[model samples]
Target: MSGDLHTEWARLFAASLKDSGVGHAVISPGSRSTPLALALARVLPATVLHDERVAAFFALGQGRASGRPSVVLATSGTAPGHWLPAAMEAREAGIPLLLVSADRPWEVQEAQASQTVDQIRLFGAHARAFFDLGLPDAHPAALAAVPRIAAQAVLATRWPLAGAVHINARFRKPLEPLPTDRGEPWRPKLAAIAKAGAPRLFPPKPAPDPAAVAHLVEAVRANPRGVMVAGPLPALDAPAMRKAVARFVRASGYTLLAEATSQLRFGLEAVRPIGAFDALLRAPDLRAALRPDLAIEIGAPAVSAQWLAWISGAEAPRRIVLPGERPADPAGGAAAMLLGPIAALLEAAAVDLEAAPPGADTASAASCYAASWQAAEAAAWAAREAAAGPQDGPLHEHHVAPMLRSILQHGGTLMVGNSNPIRDLDHDVPPDAAPLEILHQRGAAGIDGLVSGTAGARTVLDGPLVLLTGDVALLHDAGGLAAAAAVGGPLAIVAVHNDGGRIFERLPLGRDAALADDCEMLFVASHGRAFDGLAATFGLGYARVETEEALRDAVAAALAGDRPVLIEARVVAGGSATRAALLAAMAKAAVAAVSAAK
Candidate 1:
């Protein structure tokens, strides 16, 4: 009826993806995906990859970075299932990924079809939505599904509760055979637009009953050491509720332990920036300050085991939460689950409270520790600035992270590989005054999604994105580099090649006497000079840095270049001892300062 089975299949796949909000697709090559692969290859804004699992996670990372669903395309059987880890991650972390699994035609189904398996229900509970394509339906009905299925997948991914969606498709043979009058492939030029929907439900919610508010106020008023603890929250109407919360905190004279991921965490001096309450509670003075008659909980729970343990085992019998529906404890374990928003309830209370007394040192020592941490960061950067010099050749992974930071300037988002790259970055790069969004595959902590994530971030923001990765991560998503080059956007990759898994050498695996001294399986090593050739092969700008000066110059050049560039830095494994020594020196300075202040 048409040109060839592959052509029709390819057209449907492209149409479906384009109609959805997903502008990026990570494709892993295989025979089963010939039609889908050919379709993506001919289309704009699609990337072809070699590793099925990595490609899926790359797309998953892209979705996480961009705030949109990024599609994953792979051939059937284990190839489709390779997306399991990434799929599980997206489901839990609220990133959306569309899995397009190509399969054998229905005629060959369950008949020992090559590379065929029951792809349906494979993702099981991991996917938010699932659809099996290539049924006996008419072409018109099939065509009609292209847009709706795509949109649903993206919506399911981008929502607050996001997850994976599967589109299992089977294609007939002669996938892309020539036709007598094979016309140029149709490329749809329609722009994506928001769909018309019912008016959003922003129903007017009244404040908690005045008596209930009074109950909370009376509870706080009765206790001399009542305090407020705020946790991470979904985006709140900060401006609308700030005044109310401030008045409540002022009325109750409650010390606020604000988390950075919370609505009230920022824009306040008294509220401390302690990352994990557990870390703070370990200090004696901080634990003493937390000796409260009542702890008013708000929003989601904090990420501190110490805080929870302290509350669970308090000597003074702390009131860990105020009560109501949509309460502080999602697990129903808090002392009291307060009804209504804290700010609203507090407003009704309007109980008289005192300001923190001048020179009273109301804040815990942990608050001071946070300030000291800032000073240590400044001192670390000062040394780095002094020690900063140019070098080129095989690069040290340890050195690359900081140099990349210096090269990229302060504001752009940066994604790093796990293992050595991220560990190196966390140790070296100092905190900036400007908002620098640092991202990683921290949820799953995989090394396979660097390029896809970078590309997705590039699409969402008009700003530049630089990926500082190690050789393993680079090779894992090397095919993604081609996508970067093809897109011609603001993304740069700096790959540090130390040859083999340097992380292993630092582990017990390297030191075990049972292991062979020169075993290929355990103790592998590489000479870091291959990135230039690899970059050239992929049509990307290549810079080879061997000395300190050359490394700096190469980094500077890549940042200033037009297209996505790769700077390959090589160094030996043991070269990072200097960095470790420097960190230890700075940490000692902080420890000494705390001791001396006493």
Candidate 2:
């Protein structure tokens, strides 16, 4: 094998992304990616990130918390255009990212060099596949086509099977890389490109079409005024994808309406989870007597603007839309899509409606509005226990999502962020709180890599991360506070900081009188500054609080500390009189629990 051709194409592109498994690589500081960042920090598990758009949303939150694909590299004008908003938020949150970009030759861009352009398909169609390792060579069939072009850029970001891909390498000017026992004679081209894996997983989609799952199991067993909706679960806290979203709400006895970044709103066992359907779907006679005559939905379209305007202003329900990836119907009210693998099309529509078996469904069937969604979820958990029973009020920025879910306990990992902290944790959590492994970017729900996508999903979630944010999404991700002061642990941000744009005073152009002075100098851009001197110029650990019992003892001493803190609960948009007395006591106990529905 001819030696030192950019160190044998950066050691066969870091041994084909460590033989296609690719756990993490992020890197950023350039010099044409120093021999592909010193051969991915001499073979795998890399990190560096000196802000290339917070290292492409920190390798798209470690390819969305380790479902794999996290290489990201970068080096070449506009450092790969700051990874096109983390490749359009990993092509709208289906996750999985590879990116990589080093580039230079094509005769140094036909000699107009000095950092060339047209870095080949620079993330257009926000990449699902774009490989072009066209130059740097050593030729043992070009070092066995650089680990089968780094295993098809780790299998086109593993798109509906993963998401962003783009490889683009090019290198020429002796871009470092000579040592390592003189490329140990290209070590058997890393087992013939790690025996070409990953090209088959997604090519097998045809199975779920049995008459579009028997008309989605006869519109979910002829609706007892049906409803399922769930949204946001392209895999996280996978227990066989949360028992295929609890076997599609126990063989479609419906009444789920999940959200609160649905991991089916809690570790659902005997189903029927509504998580106070954003205050029991704000009753219009209990949403006109639980309206759904068959709804379905499933993934994405979360942060509910009144449950997407009550299923896009219902007049007809037969909706459908199973969407595991892309089919965000937006009010053309789905009608019918049901493609495939939403956990084997909801476990073959629960064995064609014989039901019971996923966590062995126990109850929730008799519906005529399940006693008006259990008395409007017990008058929306007693108006969220009288908005956390006063306890010396003052903390109500929508009571910090049930006070960060009562400062978490055994269950951890929660991010929230984007505007009014994910619409006040989709209207204060508790329609029986359980599934707590939350993360919300809601794909392209941009606050620009909020704290580097929760410090790259805090290296695959174990403990200590609770972000919650919104002092203008922590000042539009103050360069993701250098991964919250160089990633150690226990982040616990909780920042409600009302200095401006309190989610543009609940939109509609913040009560427009022809955009009240451009919604208060451009969308309530108030500057009461103070983030405890920006958490002492980012060495973190600051507090501020005021009441709601010192913001619940500064969130139980910032989740019993370890490092990076911040607290700041200083909210006081009192003009909205404690969010108009908790949305007028959860809209007068949602029409007095649907006029005391019997």
Candidate 3:
């Protein structure tokens, strides 16, 4: 039967999206969203995905890759909930996801509405903003609520705190198809939806308060040994801060320590901080010498537990934080918080700070910082290298990361799988070289999204794309490889094969040798074979390597071609020895480096 509800919704929803700067949508098909699905299909840039969970993640990756919001459409009930894991990750990692879920109208809902679960607040804590665009009779509210809710959600997502937005549209039945004109495209012009929300853009401004700046400048000028730590900011905000803060830090004798994820790693007077200093920062001499008179922070929460803890305990001159309406850190106990634009605050201080004067003293301080960092770096690398080695000249986890790193350094873009591959890459990937835009399936950390994320990256980025994944990750997304290979692009899939689930084997449950056999039977369900054949089956090039040298050669050779290739390297399964040996070696190296520097 025909219905105006579906058509009205389709029109409103389509127009809302068009107005919201959403150029693409990743949709998963189903009955409840017939009208909505049709609406998305009519939208040119939208793409359809079969799995709702993968679709959500694919959209997340698309958002990350494109630097814009990507809508995820799914039918009602269990399907919409499939997005939970992705939703959690997006919330934490700060990506924009517009979740458009379809539902049965009110009367039919809850009393066996089939695919309905009071979805009004279904996502709850995970979503930054929530709205319900129910039936056409409520189209006015639907038009009003969706755009406003989404803007807030996206703003929260892009702000100091990141999260997703949820919009559930309940449709009344006979959910009819919409009539449209043919030939000419179905482009609908949307009137202003409730006088569009305020732009979330952060503008350049002078100091927020002249008095506050002057006080900060006076404090810095007085303290000879202060440290300025900058945290990770969104890609959009980091550059401007980097330029503004560079002159300020250099003027005072303060050292600038920036995190790897900070995006400010390239700017002037910025030194890459030690990743974590839980153990190192506790040292009596280091603590006393490095303690700052004042600490100024400008970015998201610091991820290092040690750094946060150290600053909390160390009696500094004062703690001044420039959050600018960003979320406050509950852990930053007793630190003075300032609510204003950071650049403006700095400018108001009007302190003419210069770079640390050159000479033996400056050289000495640089040496001290470099030596400390080198020691930590060496210890980490050594420990990881010791624990991870080639298994009988065949594949091993350690062997694969370095090899893949080698290949990627030679010009291919890298997409790392979640879990072990990323950790291994962190330990051994070449550090001195340019930063590789590392794409991780961090949202949900599922194994099913690698192929699609890698492929999506290839489409958006101009570089040669490489996906470094584990065996399980590769198998879970086997179909994705087929799609990628079929698409035929300059992509490479490198998998570190260790049978299955080595991460589980490190648990205390694995300590019982008698249980090991049972555990393997229940958990390590694996088919130890080359996925190269799978690629070849799809008419794609494939390479299976046993040793480090072979893998490197294969990767190098693959990079020379235009076709997509899959290189599988079988590694020794990680066990208790792997963990123990790695930790011990790292500790030993750390002490040694610290002793030598002293």
Candidate 4:
């Protein structure tokens, strides 16, 4: 169990992680990190990823999927720097991650060693906490502090708010497990301490404040026209919170508006949440008609621009935000921030609402408000279905959503990319679709690490894993193809190739006729390259689909296979026009339906 002081110290630290319930580790190979990497491999399921950035995001996906911190080990200096992007995402998303960076001794660091930088507090505000475990020592006092440091680091990742924690371990010249004469007497004691393991940690759960609950109940009573807005939530608690929220909506008689990543969007058809709210809200008439007197927002801010705009106007509804991990009031319009377990708060509110009796007029108004939202929801979906073109025609990005829903109908994990993919899925996928575990990096909302993150999630999750990303995002993380191969799972990457960033076309800059050339040159950054050769280089299965049927079959076959597959759906550039057309049709139809219902 021990070769040198560094070996013993690293083993003790790794054992503490296991004791604190860390189950997985992602390692990037390097010399300085040899001891910690070897130690972690012994106690947990470890994967070696060549790229540190990819490894960090891979660990991020694991944390998001598993609801526990996954260890990410890298050498000192710039290796840990690569983790900054993923760390920022983890912080914003409330995912737990443990980043261990190995460094040179203090003297060498002072002398400006080759692979050493100021590893202390490297992640700045992005990390929940930072620890610099100075040079490894075998003194009984020093060995005793190892487990304490590990415990504190792991706890910090989850407490107050879930995010990442950094531990910078500095080692002497012999970074390997070579024998040394420094700590011969402490060997048996160190082994015993490692064997005993650190004490298991149980974090306290925050309860809903009685005063806040009473205030929310009174607000709901006063405002019969209320709506529950469910945005992106922590994956682990989403299921429980979904049930609780459904109970609250029924008790309070409010319509539910759920985003795609909200987890409440699917599996709650009984509650009948407004599935097409993004399109429905686009119509000014409908937005005015459905203006809620009170809005109960849970989880992070939604991804829909229309939703944000609707909620930001002068007549915006009073927002009661139940923040998870962090405050989610980006519009700065929250009337109340209920700080506690969201499910618990919702459950408490539901109980209070059930106990109170509403007047007949209040009951009638709430029922009518919910009914109007339902009519608009139905109309929006009807319009989208009516506008569907022939399946055999040229592929468009709009087709990916329903095609994916059909492919993964039974059960699977769907990781959507940032750009148009997530937005499309949010607008198109309905509540009737089978419940699939949807994952996205909506924390920072960037398109950098979709492939590697999905691969990482595969290591922890069961069933087939599918990543629906754009061509540009796929290319950005092309190196992650190697990670997908190494992890070895049924991962189907559906890369929607629109030649470039088609999402930019929807913005103001793309709409300007004079800026067409500039938009194409800089904003879109079109790279007309096929992914077949890239797949071949990584030894992954490859398929190119241009028709709806082909896409369906390719995804089904890819899921059927055990290895990773890249299914590129090549569509013409500028599909945003088609998206705009569909939205306009949906909005018009929704307004008409709402007016008729009234």
Determine which window of 10 residues in candidate 3 has minimal summed lDDT. Answer: 182-191
Candidate 2 CA-lDDT value: 0.71
lDDT of each: 0.60, 0.71, 0.62, 0.87
List, residue by residue over 1-598, the lDDT tens digit for candidate 4: 2457787788889989989878799999999999999999999999999899999998998998898899999998799999998999988888899999998887776686698788889989999999999888767888887887889889989887889999998887677778577568888878888877887667887888899889889999999999988888766676787789889998999998988788888767468888788888888898899999999888888888887887788868788988764667888878888877888888998899999868889999999999999988888888888886766788878888888987887878789999889998987777763577789898999998889889889898988788999999999999889889988868899999989998889999989999999999999998989999999999999999998889988998988898999999987556888889889988999999989987
Worst 10 residues of 2 by lDDT: 356-365
- Misplaced by over 4 Å in model 1 are 1-20, 26-44, 48-54, 75-79, 134-136, 139-149, 173-399, 459-461, 505-529, 572-580
Which should have the higher TM-score, number 2 or number 3?
3
- Candidate 1 vs. true structure, TM-score: 0.66
User: How do these models rank on TM-score, best leading?
Assistant: 4, 3, 1, 2
Q: 296, model 2: CA deviation in Å? A: 6.5
* Top TM-score model: 4
Task: Give the alpha carbon lDDT tens digit for every residue of 1-598 in model 2.
Answer: 2456676567667877777778888788889878888888877777787778888887787778767878878788778888788788788887888888888777667577787888888878888888887776544676666666676677667544567888888777667755555545555654454455322233344467788878887776666557777767743644565686576665555677777676666667676576667555555666777676777777776576767787677454668887765667777757788766677777787787764332223234434465577677767767767765564676667666776776674577788777677666766666443557777777778877777877788777776568888777787777777766777567777778778876676677776688778878887788878777777786878888866678777767766777778788886665344554665577678677778775
**Candidate 4: where are CA atoms >4 Å away?**
1-3, 179-183
**How many clashes (backbone atoms < 3 Å, residues ≥3 apart in a chain or on different chains) does model 4 have?**
0
Note the residue pairs that clash in candidate 4: none
List model 1 lDDT by residue over 410-472, tens digit each: 456666666777556645554332334455564445666577566555555556577778887
